[model samples]
Target chain A: MDARSPKRGRRRHGRFDVLWFLGVPILLIVAVEIVPMLGVVWISLTDYNPLEPDSWLSFVGGENYSRMLGDDLFWQSLLNTSYFALLYLPIAIFGAMVAAILLNQQLRGRLVFRGIFFMPVVVSWVVGSTMIMWFLDPSSGLPSMISESLGFGRLPQLLQDESTAMPTVAFVAIWKYFGYNTVIYLAGLQAIDSALDEAAKVDGASALRRFWHITLPGLRPVTAVVVMLNMIQAMRIFDPMMIMTNGGPNNSTTSTVLYVYRMAWDNLQFGYGSAITAVLSVIIFAIAGLQFWFFNRRSVER
Target chain B: MSVEAKHVQTPSRGAAGEGRLGKVVTYGLLSVGALVILGPFLWMVRSVVTPNEVLYSDSGGGIIPRQFTLDHIKDAFTAGVQPFDVYFVNSLIVTVIAVVSNVIFCGLAGFALARIEFVGRRAVTVVIVLMLAIPIESRIIPLYILASRSGLSNSYFGIALPLLVTSMGIFLMRQYVMTIPRELDEAAKVDGCSSWRLYWKIIFPICRPVIAAIAIFTFITAWNDYMWPLVIIQSQDMQTLPVAVGNMAVVKDQLRWGTLLAFSLLSVTPVLVFYLFLQRQFMAGITSGAVKG
Candidate 1:
């Protein structure tokens, strides 16, 4: 392996070899990702508006950040996003765990079952969110029909009701993503050493005990990854909120990203929108950092 | 490798003494799960074929529609600000360019990071990993500004530029490339093959599976992307399917249940068809990419 290292190879080296291979992607990333990332910080400090080109050159200091602190809608949207994550995270993780265990079983049509579960993941969010709206539509949806058939009284308009809109949106988000988490979990479950489970069985351990002791421990790393990724995704939820509820009835389902979108596009408040985005970016980075620290500490301890 | 070997052995262990009752329970549970998972999609399809009269009627909600019609689908194509066909073509153009650029650019970068002894390889890898943790949505404001300022907005290139080389794609390709034995490259070098020749003639050809995986993932993602395209492309004729469908939802009048459902069905059909044909590879690609990350 050392002999095969390009640095030590017999072939003559060129000064620009790295540039040849890395130039295009590096340039693209810098232009698209890196530049914009740095620009967001600057943009957040200014009162820039696309609609009024004159405001683009002016800086308003920390006014945007101060305004965001006092803005009820910004705080409400942040809370709404947190609420969605809090509700969706446990259900998605636990449901995916259960589904992954079932898929991992020696059952007929397991592959078909996996495919069925993952079907929603392939469907675009626009479609999934739209279908969910139709499914929950009080006037002519399945929920109302089912309620009527079961004599369970009239169903509320889930998306249009402030009390129910956030939860309904969260449920749709969970439905769209749990299959993906399940696939990751299934991969994690498959990677666990079967011999450990078999050994526990031979020691007269019950199925529940084996799963609790062996399988659960084996899946900790995957669970951390799944939890962190899902949380980040949930915190940034936009499409479902945009499509199904539009941050209404009365901003109940407004996510942080959706709020940023509205501020910038709908209100033409680019600086204020960038300020919220900066806050969100910080929060997300902190969450990710905390997750990595926790996971790395746990792995080291084991 | 050990895990895979045990996976093959464990199935036999489960089958040897498992009860008929257990099998029944497994099948029953899986059937219910499948029904729940597929129910919404079936309802979407049902709505697409159901006439507006039946769809709006009180007694009309079922997996099977009372009366069928393609009129809603026909209207969905024709009843937008711009025809749905234009949006579909715009989506195709953006997605095609994105997929091709991702494969070429990410493939080149992945190969270099995996095989080349670059001066700043470690730094580049760390930066990519860090970038993965940052959600692209958080950076949208500035990206939108940059695109607008550069006059890339409302064009296919603007829609495709930000997505041309994903950090995940680079990481996925790098991981796959690393698994290709170094001896092969060394042997190529011994045969007097230039570095470019080695990549083009030997390495790239062997990376077909990973390339396919990247292609499918990139294509689906680029096709289904909404927010970026919504911000970038303003003109009705230039809007992608997701953006156009999103606009339809917002407009209220064009968003009748039948028409909206038909629109949803049409928008997702291509990716759904792609997944149906290559699900194994798609699933493998996702799980492998996730595990490596």
Candidate 2:
């Protein structure tokens, strides 16, 4: 009995050793990810500037939040980001669905098509943004030259024009990201059983009816996942806007992230940036919670 | 055998004319979509080979030269240019360290999160989910302050450390690892193997597919990351690929379209090759983690 108890103790000690491997990294992740996030929240309550002396700063609760409420750029950014999400989400998701359905059909040279679409996803956003920038350049861009050729008149540099800047960014985002979503949808489509289509056919269903009744319903889970994923991605868009537009012409295309970055880095208003982050986080969490709620509802309904 | 054969074979007439029209339309739309998708890349390549005079002259016309030259490609690195070789190297070193560390640390953390029944697991999962949602840009300022305080602002460790604890990585590994049966752990335990030894000797090997998936994802993400490097690494010698291109654009006044395009294409080659080599696993990775999120 004594010998057996000692063995059990040794086994317990060995099990405890596994904790060592995890303890440090878990702590580090908490420190870096959670701690700074908390700092963002705290700093939102205080006026802390990285450039100014620490002693010169003062705590002003809710002032930054109220100021943000009235800040013109903040509202503009909110509008732009919303416009971006509104335009890109439905169009890109619909486009990807269409693309995925088409590709799911029996076709030759399909691999080449798959590879072509997937290329943009793999390409860095920086490269894509720069290429798009060149393609849209006012004087020497390909679009301008094409317009001239087609006798459509010289195209205004879209990125430079405030009227077109936000849309232009959205267009690029769609182009770069649709292929990724399409591939996911393709995987989802493949998972669907063919038996349902056969049953619908045997019931003398029309092609359109078959699609509406069978295919679309089958793709619900994937569609939900795609919509939520794209929402978050589209909401946090910054690099492309920063590189291509710089919130430019007249802050036409600035996003929340870019605004926050400019606030923190350019204006040295760390506290205000933190406040923007807080607001943005709340909005994101709300959207994500809505997605989860909808998802659970669907599952329950089935 | 005959029953199976009959089950496998189903004779059917192809769809009628209206269906044919639908197929044509679908294919046509897909073709146009492909053109839209591949257009920029083709133009990016064409502009590299075509002289600036021709590229700027014609837009939609076929610009692929019957005879091609490496002049622009050469000029990207040679034209009394700082050349991107150094940028490539710096990016490579940083990406390697970051990817390697993320793979190891995230794997262990993921295993713990997935397989280990311990206190605070639910909280850890919640934290990871929330972290994944919070944009990294939000925390950039504070992260910068922390790095500076730790004297890690410009070093490899500084750039690599913050990224090492990716919430996506933990989530990915947990999802993949969860699919494996706990009975495997029990079986190993019955074999008189310690838990640490079981993980090192058994579980790690079985987790290769997930590891590969994570490794590729982490590497690509780190490779393309521009914002953090842009803020932290101030010097030219320490610049990554995207930073180099950004700095080049700033310096050249954005007029050097040909050279800029060439540099852009050059920078994406390693990533393009990496994708081609691991196409299957990469699709799996993208769908499993990034797409779901």
Tell me the TM-score of each prediction against the true structure: 0.94, 0.91
lDDT value, residue A224 of candidate 1: 89
In terms of DockQ, which candidate is strongest? 1
What range of 10 consecutive residues in model 1 chain B has the weakest lDDT sum?
A: B9-18
The per-model lDDT (C-alpha) reads: 0.82, 0.77
* Cα error, candidate 2, residue B122 (Å): 2.9
| Pairs with backbone N, CA or C atoms under 3 Å apart (clashes), candidate 1 | none
Candidate 1: where is the Cα deviation over 4 Å? A1-13, A52-56, B1-25, B61-63
True contacts kept of 2: 0.43
Mind giving the per-residue lDDT tens digits that candidate 1 earns over A151-220? 8955787777788888888888888888899999988988888777777766888767777888898898
Which residue pairs in model 2 clash with each other?
A: none
- Measured against the native two-chain assembly using Cα atoms, what DockQ does each of the candidate structures obtain, in the order listed? 0.54, 0.46
User: Which parts of model 2 are misplaced by more than 4 Å?
Assistant: A1-15, A52-57, B1-18, B53-62, B65-68, B79-81, B250-254, B290-293
Tens-place lDDT digits, model 1, residues B1-293: 26665664654233212466766766776788787777778777878888888777667645466587998889877775676688889999999999999999899899888988867899998888788788788788888888887899988999998789988888888988999999898777667777788888988999999888888888878998999999988787898989988877765563376677777898888888878888888787765666668
